[model samples]
Target: MTQRFMRATGRLRIIFGPAHSSSLDHEMTEENQRLLKQRQAEAQQWETIRRPDGSTYVVPKNPEDKSLR
Candidate 1:
């Protein structure tokens, strides 16, 4: 029997399944690990500010509200 699994990104869907081997499982694991690393690297490239309360926010390159400045 084959099973299907879907990864969701908001309204977007990524489907990969029906895999039937240990090799397939290993491949999927590697792919997920690679994607996670890529996302971590991308996040590190962005600017973020940490609050004293332990919350964090991404610093916008442009401010939409002029009064904020």
Candidate 2:
């Protein structure tokens, strides 16, 4: 068969099958999911504080120096 004839099948790929996305979340482990949630929780507690000197810094909004709220 000619190259043009064989190349025709490549055009039908979209109708033939879906592409596999390796990035799908089905691969995430339970510990990875748990860590993601924990990081989100930690991110929420931060509050931006602008000082009169225009200096900027970050500290835990509720740093008990003991527990994670």
Candidate 3:
């Protein structure tokens, strides 16, 4: 029996079958890494506000002048 290995999302995965594990894993890993990095960058760019009541909310970059109810 032969065991195939694949890499996805910066992680290694093992597959057993006729599937091309190496190519598939490389592609998956690249795409997953790209998406993860993108998300991380976006998260860092956003500003979050935490309320004293243990609630958290995202602060809008632009706020309209409105009276608070």
Candidate 4:
């Protein structure tokens, strides 16, 4: 399966002279990467199964996880 990860380049602003815009952009990029990693980790713990009704459901591979819907 293809992995879905965000390619966030962060927000850029018009740097006229001296400003902390680059730092702010870097923060945003870091946040995006963190979230992307979190999602990938969650996906790894789940497995996709198709029901008899032709609907797909994501269930955790770890049977101990009682978060099944």
Q: Which candidate should be chosen as best, given lDDT against the real structure?
A: 2
Give the clashing residue pairs of candidate 3, or none: 9-29
Per-candidate clashes come to 0, 0, 1, 0
Error of 3 at 57 (Å): 0.5
lDDT per residue as tens, model 3, 1-69: 234222332233333434443433445568888998878765655578899999999864435522221
CA deviation > 4 Å runs, candidate 3? 1-28, 60-69
TM-score of each: 0.33, 0.41, 0.41, 0.45
TM-score of 4: 0.45
Ranking by TM-score: 4, 3, 2, 1
lDDT of 4 by residue, 1-58 (tens): 1111112222222333322332333455688889988888777889999999999998
Residue 44, model 3: Cα distance from true site in angstroms:
0.8
Off by over 4 Å in 2: 1-27, 52-55
| Model 4, global lDDT | 0.61
Worst 10 residues of 1 by lDDT: 1-10
- Whole-structure CA lDDT of model 1: 0.56
What lDDT score is found at residue 61 in candidate 3?
Answer: 41
